[model samples]
Target: MARPSTAHLGVDLDKAGKQVGFISIPHSPHEDAWGAVRIPICVIRNGSGPTVILQGGNHGDEYEGPIVLGELIRDLDPATISGRLVILPAINLPAVLAGRRTSPVDGLNLNRTFPGDPAGTITQQISAFVSDVIFPIGDMFVDLHSGGSSLNILPSAIIEPAPDPAHRRRNVEAVLAFGAPLTVVIDNLGEPRTSTACAVRAGLTTVGTEMAGAGTVSLDALKICRQGVRNVLAHAGVLLPAAAAPAAREPEAILKIPGQAGFVFATADGVFEPCHPLGTMVRSGQEAGRIHHLADPSRPPETLRYGADGMVYGHRQPGRVVLGNCCAVVASPYEGSLD
Candidate 1:
């Protein structure tokens, strides 16, 4: 049964046309009584076929997905597509506008609140609409992401293994089809409330990404992100003449993050100085970074070391670090050229 969501979609998904709409989020704040936060959404449908839901701006500071999606919404046409293309350039309107990772309004992390409560806060309502309304309609999903203000990461596509072997295999295939330089299968760190998890519960294949970060978008990141979208669409049968992409891209190198053993965290609060760059291989006991006590020059700097031999897949963006902050993340290599 489809519940009428508090978040309203402004367009008809069944109609064979292109339309721009908003997911109207009700907000009655002290400033205004009749105001609503409108999140951008677009639908392009030519005929009956698979539906692909593409979104970015889950975190306000991440630019790769939002940049690529905004361009897609403006340039994509209904006649060119065989099925339906749903685009949400900015999924979290409050956070996106505020340029923060979480919604400044309710201090909610949208990604962490999925299969949400319709009667909850603004972010929860949006999440509920996506899980209940959007997930039901779309056959495939891509929620793009980046490291945001706190981290810089190698361009990668991330997927969690489905419980079923066939579903797991197909999900891997989709990640390969996206053809990012690095493909990581997260073995742990389950985000049960994510849109991808919602899609999985509905038995749909999904692929999400972690592109360039540090809270800024680069031309190179956009180029790969746009191509990845095309590759996935062609792979999913939503776009015609798959040759529109390169005959073939170099196969992505598969990596795996095996639980908490895969990360290095800072124990002391200070300014962190990284010893390695993204994609660098590190040996166990090697110094990942050094935390300097800016306030106390006499105090010896604390050095963070790798506990396992692996590639440095992620790093904090800002040099400053705090106790318990993840300083670097490592991933075990699987196969293929990392070139």
Candidate 2:
């Protein structure tokens, strides 16, 4: 028997054996005044074995993952693969094209609206499509992300805790396969709307990765991310394992602090001169940076201090600062499992 033709939009997959194509999900209808758009999903499937997905551009500002995935798609050879590999380089195409953080039409953060409603906004419709069409088709999921906008996150993989111990083990194994220096295991803190959180809730092992800063793609970060993706494929038994390079050091557990504790912001608008750089260690109450009043030459710069003993993970880029803007983030050690 001949294979069935699976065609949607401009993507066609040969479903006879292993097919790779695009699936069009319904979007909000557009009137003559406003036209509806159809979201196209790129799917790569092998006839047999497990299915893995690589999604990027969830936050349009984070460009590394999408660029890396684009390169991977051009270079991938499905003949040697054992399972399905679905790569969606630009999940939020509108945001990516506009170079904005949120969808220009809806102004919604796609990441925060997973498992969304079909009748909701355009973002919700896309989320519903992913949940209905993509989630159940994959055995493993890898949602690629990076620090959006002003944040610069270290290259790391984040895995949410699975109820099943075996699934959790697999999740960790998959993250280890990425070969990133840092791996953070988190349990949803009542934030079940995230894609990773939803995947775990469905009993599927998922891995979330963050690489480089936002707004631009770093070549060094892209190289590391590509290697990580290859490593994941190899680890999942979809592709043959090649000689592995020297592994980076394992990451320490991340300690997420209470978001309600108002972050110390600049009291005066001026140039922010940091007393310490990123990755610096500080004790409780140690001075982190200083805010100099550029407008007044006579006033002394106000010293910024840490609230607890921890490592500096995030800080604002050196520039003119405004009053009431966050200065830096310190990562403190967690005494117990941070779930």
Candidate 3:
């Protein structure tokens, strides 16, 4: 059954200039019967032009996106743009506040719940509101992320070729404009419920990133996050070029990760020891990592290896792993732009 959408924002999105408010998801808990979960949002409009939706903190543990978007929320003004820019610094408030990958209220991964339910869990309701209400207003959508608390990454962007050729082309252009040090084309891994997948289905040019992680943020990661977002804004014509826009990521290497072969998973619960670091180029069948049985120190470790020749782009975090956990991901050789 199609549940009635209950999420609402406290601000008027149609108004011009900068407006600050919150998307209030009604919550009737034991403490506050009528209190709502407020997700901070900023809508900056200058006349009438393309609408770009910038979303960050999709995963609560990812810090770079939230940090940079918070800066934009506080510092960005209305006079600098030609179109509309809607920014959500911490979209998943419960997860962000709890410092986890899933929402504390519902224990659901926001990324996995797209085209959401109105009368479902709190997280699902938020996703439904965004997908049903806010997404239609966007001409382009950019979502930023990293490895979050569970992994470390190589400051890369993920660009999936949309089923529509036009959408695919536009998305690819947006990803290039993002200009991350490394951009990749990957299949959606058969998951069509992700933010990227949902945006693509909506025919919106979408771009997302997996910049850096280890349950923390970094100065370099912030710089990359800030620059990439600005570049996309400039490219989408939402932000006019400054005296000099942020530097483009030169010498970028584009790779493709097609299907499950690109990933390395832990077969048993153990400590993962990686043989190669992120950004390392390795040949097929190479030793990617090994899982050691810390519980039984005398037992020999079970080795893990790569399935193909590619560049290592992501790895599990904290050197720990559980059975069936993804330990690493590799991408194929560069086939796109250089600078």
Candidate 4:
């Protein structure tokens, strides 16, 4: 069994009104012996209903989520919603402050530190609190994410296909209701330590996003996230349904990433030259991009190819890349429904 978490909430989670406070995690670093890292948290409860946990800043560089969630926290009236909305706009405060993917304090990626250890590092402790405490109160989990500083991704709702048919259907419904430009069904992306994985293990209806990313927030992506979150909340019965917009439409496409094969990695360190933009369809073994050996003008550029036939879902944002870095990811059209 895991150790009990040392984290504590500053506000009452069970209260009947809007409460905003911090999740104070005890951190005794070199500078301070009794210091605590206070993560921003807000709980909005009307009457008794299901609880939805909304998280952002899982990866610090992703700004779209934090921006949208923050807006929701400030603008959303507690009276308009039932149940609760537990908001964590900047979950990884250290990373968000540094504007990096991983925590500056522990150098660990918060996303991969799920089901965390209470007796471990700061990042692990935060994860442990979420897994052991917060998840138990949540009927659904919505983790908002973008490509962060690494890649540019098409705006899409992402989910891992659950083993149980009924559970899988609910997830599908939530994703479709989110109504992003695309719906991506990826089986944990070959890493099961993510927030989505932890929430799934805890039996919460989990949904994530891969909105526009390239180290900067996009206005279009923000618009998509804002509306998508509201739609999901309404679908979960936490909030009353909003008036349908005149431009409302179903998701533009549904795609699936075939395990690890869907991702194309850099084989050597060099400047990447992408051959196609996001959403371009290509066949297996097609040239996805090349790594130019800028240092050695005489050396031939290392050509990279797609591992499968699919649309380009994402690619590295930075011009330079190292071996094993994900250069591109492809997702095939999902013909069958998760249901």
Candidate 5:
């Protein structure tokens, strides 16, 4: 019923040793009639075990996932692992190359085009290739992401709400195994058109991350991303425990974003001034920030207040904001049990 993808893979996924290749997606522009966008992928296999799919660069500006996954593709010895590792460091090659959130080829957000259309735009075609060609063979999916150029998010690992309790529990376990300083149990964040959603719907254990973001990469976030990938591999049995040095077991805070009220948004276009930094504890109705009206200096600055009580999970990065732009998001500690 679905059209076949116009993408070609140069690497054999079932191959024994580590093989590096590209997923060539056909393209035709005014400058060239027959051109292709080559997305780099690496396949590492040793023996029989669960296959783990690791990916990054869903957004052009987020650099942590691509950096850590790139290093893994180069340094990870296939012989030390029991299963396969299908790594796509820069899944959205066009966006990564352009350093923009959406692809320059089609001006579409790859994240929102899940289980995509082969007959659609370049972004949709890429999504279709990943959904059709990739998701079917994966046992677990790990997508790394940062806030990109928009927000500064606290370092956290996120697990989506699954179809069943058992599946949800598996995702929760994966988040724990990921061992990020902040673990978030999300209920889709009102956006279902994501790679994580695609993987989860296909019954794969999915774990995603929100490493620090703000256009520039953070060293602290990089450390978490690097170690988190290894932790997930070790947890999935794809990598031996000895091969991946685990982080010191510590009691990490598990949080959940309360729907709607947890977010603070700009009501009008203006320059924003935050009252608190991320990780700060605040109460509902508290002054979160203020937006100064530049067009009319006489108008008093609008004071934005929190709608929910929790830790400041994320906030807008740039000083300028437009109407409906998210200014801050609060997350409360999750007391519910996944078990």
Candidate 6:
């Protein structure tokens, strides 16, 4: 069968039975300091069926997603599958190679620049590529992400509002298949800047999976993601394997906290001694943690307290705690939800 052509954005689909490759969606040249960066994509199709795009490395520091996508490409046997699979392991090449959160030149987040501008900044150019070249070709989508530098997030999936019940159910079910202990279903709270949300708005069943952390790879997390991808394929009938036994369902809940309620740090520079562990539940007035004068143990420790009751979702890693830096994140139930 002949592949479809997209002339508007210089995209062409090259297919071999169930395997298809998208070639040469041009990106704006990187700044002089960063050298040139090109965006490349490949699509694999298995006979005739639904199309799915699996993307990773939206944030340059998230390693697990890109690694897992690499493994998927290597292990995938197109002749054995039923539909098409588009794999983009490095969506933000410059950011990925630079090991930074955003493009070094633009200093803008690629993830937040989705549905991009054709005549905008470098980040906007990449966003336009995804919006024009990628989103239109898929029936379902999975975007992979992780904690950027200096943060460790428990593996979870983010499911935004679905346009319909069927898509919503599939979104949740697909997330659960990833076997992450936590699954956060967010309304996105008007953050339309996200790729997944953009895809969802475009009427695609999209979900974002969060694995490992900051520029580091965890083999265990990779395994979980790998299995999760396969499970999603099986669920979608792209792969003919039986679904794996389900993992224990973690207590599912939404977190609510004031928009202003995040990690509160001390004004003076000092050594931080956290009084709480990750996932600790705290009340509004409870001391979440503290900072102390490194040289004077006698001096009073600066107390950090929450403005609301909730569980800690994340905390500052061992390092200098700067003023205005978030030291902890408290997750409460859905009444005052950000989602």
RMSD of each: 2.7, 4.9, 2.6, 1.9, 1.7, 4.5
* Native-to-model Cα distance after best TM-score fit, residue 73 in candidate 5, in Å: 0.7
lDDT of 4: 0.88
Can you tell me which runs of candidate 5 are displaced by over 4 Å?
A: 1-3, 245-252, 335-337
- Tens digit of per-residue lDDT, candidate 1, span 47-132: 87899999899999998999889988888777778899989999998999999999998999998888878888989888888887
What is the Cα-based lDDT of residue 121 in candidate 4?
Answer: 93
Candidate 3 accuracy as TM-score: 0.94
Could you tell me the TM-score of candidate 5?
0.96
Q: What's the lDDT for candidate 6?
A: 0.70
Among the numbered candidates, top lDDT falls to: 5
lDDT, candidate 4, at 22: 98
Q: What is the TM-score of each candidate against the true structure?
A: 0.95, 0.81, 0.94, 0.95, 0.96, 0.82
By lDDT: ranked, best first: 5, 4, 3, 1, 6, 2
Model 4: number of clashes? 0
Global lDDT of each model? 0.84, 0.68, 0.85, 0.88, 0.90, 0.70
Model 6 per-residue lDDT tens digits across residues 11-97:
344465433333343344533443335554666776778888889878888888888888777777788778888888888877898
Better of 3 and 6 by lDDT: 3
lDDT of 5 by residue, 106-225 (tens): 999999999889888888988898888888899999999999999999999997878688998889888788878898877756687999998999899999999999989899999988
Clashes of each: 0, 2, 0, 0, 0, 9
- Tens-digit lDDT track of model 3 for 1-339: 234677777888889988989999999878898999999999999976899999998999999999988888888888888899889989999999999999988889999999888888888888888888888889999999999989888887778667666777788778888867888876657787788788888889899998789898877888888888988898888887662255454323568874688889998988999998788998778899999998899999989989878889889997778888989988886564322
> Measured by TM-score, how close is model 6 to the native structure?
0.82
